[model samples]
Target: MSWKTVLNEIKSSDGVLEVVDARCPNEFRSKRLEELFNEWEKPFWIIINKVDIVPKAFADRSKKFLKENSDAVDVVHVSSKKFYGFWILRRSLKSYFRDNKAKLVVVGFPNVGKSSLINMLAQCTVVSTAPVPGHTKGKQWIRISSKLLLSDTPGVIPKEFASRDWAKILFPDDVEESAFILLEKIKNAEGSNFEELYGFSPEPSEETLERIALKFRFLKKGGEPDTNRAATKLLNDWNNCKLTAWWL
Candidate 1:
């Protein structure tokens, strides 16, 4: 998202609730958004979402790292899907708006559960969900009650979002490259069995994908393995938390 769009959302909100993926802390955070919160003097609360996919220690360490790096108003770790740690965030918001109604703008990178959290808070599917990044478009100002309001906008991309950075929001053709990046991240992370997961060593080329195709029996006509199918499957598994050795 452009800075102007984010600015508009901030202008309309009383506070900011930023959601981030707990599995990949470094990749999900946006310094630009945090700077905006500080510049506007708005309370900045971070929700380290998808904590259920990773270990508890990952969230704890990530909370510490983020708190030390940024002057956020508060940081809470939770899983939006299963509603873990949702109570803490709910209580915090309720307390903040006890005497006055509060309107908060939800911001985050794509695929970080911004819409899902809104649904959880409203106890209904107020916003739609798409697994593909950059799928959410437009905005809505939802009224939960007299005490609170929520403004949901499209996920914001960080200033550092570019070729050098991992593509959080990917096009269809970008899936293979994104999957390769995801594999490398797991390979470099502590205690990850990236090689063992696919039953083959990692390589910059199609070696990992070829192995995956053979392992999963993803084949083309005449029994030739389909690497594209394998690649997509691997990516889907990683995204859905079916394939993750370690995360922090």
Candidate 2:
């Protein structure tokens, strides 16, 4: 279902569950959702999930950035995979709805751990989950606690432009440039060796597609680097969280 429709129907929603992938906080920012939340006067708590793979420094910065820039009542870093930080989240939720059960609608970009949050909060596997994006196709009501009801909706990703938009996505022709841009971000954030993560070193203006092609043995006629294939593989690796220490 479209987010517009959901937001319209839930104008009376007690709150919004704004889930975001902590590893790719910049990429997951949703201007549209923020606008809707503000328009509808719906209070939100930004849940920065998937904290296990990230350094605490990164997680702390992400939470601070989100809290400072947004009108969120609260922001908490969580890792459903490692069973971390849910106790604080649970306490916050319970405190928020001390007198009445609040009906909250969970929304976020694809694969941000919405279902996993529901499962963790309920302390059972009440919603289906997958490692892939768009795994939860529709909406379901999940009881997180006696005083909290969550409406888990499909993960709605912003429409990916075929061009570079952070790690959001890349246009086919812009794939190599996108890789360089993302690598630059990693350099600034983690300062990890790009070669260690991607299996090849990148030279200034040296094509990432070529490096990936040679490293992965992706070749075309005359043993030429299969650039298109290589570019797609590189992006897929990024999409699947394979090519970076700080991958989302």
Candidate 3:
């Protein structure tokens, strides 16, 4: 769906839930979206999804940081895979809306587990979910409870992200360059375990891709390390949550 459509949906909703990846909460957040929510005068909350992979301390710190820095009413950390923090989220919503029913819109960048969270909350699969970016092609309104409704939208990037490297890294035209950028981010993040996850420490260089290619037996003609294939695999792993990293 287009950003204009998403904005229209948001305008129709009573509140907004901005789902973000717990592994890199700050990087995934959209300041422009927050500004829009504020301008619309809708209740806004930050849902930090995928807390199953990151440390609890990291999740807490992330929540605290967002609460301090953003305009969100509250920040909640949750693990959709492990079914954690659902009650708290529900309670927060209930307290805010009181006796009146509310229609909320869930928004976020691609592959941040919005659909999965919705499924977990509704206790069934109401929307399709996939590991890749832009898997949610359209919108669906789901009733999580008698008083609460949710609108699921396709992952969207705001206009401000057009110039950012991280945004380009999300839907990259060049996979190898994007992989290199992701590798550098992971290498620099605190508490990232490159060796534990991939069996070797990366050096933020093309040689790292070569090593990963050889290690995973991704080869091309004449037995050369297939850097493109290796980069694709690395990006896949990152998107699929097979690899985990967090920055503060």
Using TM-score, give the best candidate's number. 3
Taking the tens digit of each residue's C-alpha lDDT, what string does model 2 give over 123-209? 643443323234345445666665566665544544551124543443435666666665566655553345776666544234777
Task: List runs of model 2 lying over 4 Å from the truth.
Answer: 115-139, 155-157, 160-181, 200-206, 245-248
For every model shown, what is its TM-score relative to the native structure?
0.80, 0.76, 0.88
Tens-place lDDT per residue, model 1, 1-248, is: 57677778787678888888777775677777778778888887888887777777777888998888777767887777886776687677777668687878888776677877777665643433323234345545555554666765545665355335355323345666766776776767654445657766555457778788899899999898888888788777766666654454
In candidate 2, residue 116 scores what lDDT? 75
Error of 3 at 43 (Å): 0.8
Give the CA lDDT, 0 to 100, for residue 222 in model 1: 87
lDDT, model 2, position 162? 17
Candidates by lDDT, descending order: 3, 1, 2
| C-alpha lDDT (0 to 100) for residue 218 of candidate 2 | 90
Please give the lDDT score at residue 199 for candidate 1: 67
Q: Judged by lDDT against the true structure, how good is candidate 2?
A: 0.66
The reply for model 3, stretches above 4 Å from the true place, is 124-140, 158-163
What TM-score would candidate 2 get against the native?
Answer: 0.76
Worst 10 residues of 3 by lDDT: 124-133
For every model in order, what is the number of clashing pairs? 1, 2, 0
| C-alpha local distance difference test of each model | 0.70, 0.66, 0.81
